[model samples]
Target: MSPRRSRKTSFEDKMARLEAIVEELEKGGLELEKAISLFKEGTKLVEELSEMLRDAEIEIENLYSEDDLNGD
Candidate 1:
């Protein structure tokens, strides 16, 4: 069998995929197994995206802190 498509690492791509999953779930036609799989994948995407945002926030804070020290 062919390999599964790789999950994206970028935050935007993850968000897009998560949104698509949500839309698919909302449409109400998926089999029980498929819905469970999508839900699990969506949960993972949310966790990864949350981590990315947290890292970005920390980076932004560090940049501002440096600017404050430099009187910028």
Candidate 2:
């Protein structure tokens, strides 16, 4: 993959990439180096998505608290 393609990768995009990775792994055609790199990238994607979700949840909770405090 190109550097630009790798940089803009998102949760959904990475999930799709990971699905392709799985299919490739299942098909047993990728070289060891490529497979390892894909696995590492997929791990990064999982962590990135998890952190994004945690931040989103915190924001949602804060918004709810603010609404309650405002007597809305």
Candidate 3:
């Protein structure tokens, strides 16, 4: 996926695509080039998804820390 398209795509959509790629790879019989292409895309999606999760975790932590500071 292009960087622009990926930026617009939601995390759930990327995860679904990654799952589909894994299923296809697992099933076998893909041409070597196609399989490699799918593998690259899957890895890219994994990186993007991991970053998104990390960002969310940081945001949540910050929110809770702010609450603690406020004695809420």
The list of candidate 3 runs beyond 4 A from truth reads 1-9, 55-72
Q: Write model 2 residue lDDT over 1-72, tens digit each, in one string.
A: 887767556657867876776777778878999989878877787777677567453333365677588897
Candidate 1: residue 21 Cα off by (Å): 0.2
Distance (Å) between predicted and true CA of 40, model 3?
A: 0.3
Q: Give the Cα-based TM-score of candidate 3 against the true structure.
A: 0.64
Q: Residue by residue across 1-72, what tens digits does model 3's lDDT show?
A: 898786667777998999999999999999999999999999999998898777453333355676688896
Residue-pair clashes per prediction, in order, are 0, 0, 0
Candidate 3 lDDT trough over 10 residues, lowest sum? 55-64
Selected candidate, larger TM-score, 1 vs 3: 3
| TM-score, predicted candidate 2 vs. hidden true structure | 0.51
Candidate number of the best lDDT: 3
- The candidates, ranked best first by TM-score, are 3, 1, 2
Better of 1 and 3 by lDDT: 3
Model 1: runs farther than 4 Å from truth? 1-9, 55-72
Error of 2 at 25 (Å): 1.9
Q: Quantify all predictions' global Cα lDDT against the true fold.
A: 0.82, 0.73, 0.88
lDDT of 1 by residue, 20-71 (tens): 9999999999999999999999999999888756745333345467668889
TM-score each candidate.
0.62, 0.51, 0.64
- Model 1 lDDT, full chain set: 0.82
Candidate 2: regions farther than 4 A off: 1-9, 55-57, 60-72
Candidate 1 clash pair list: none
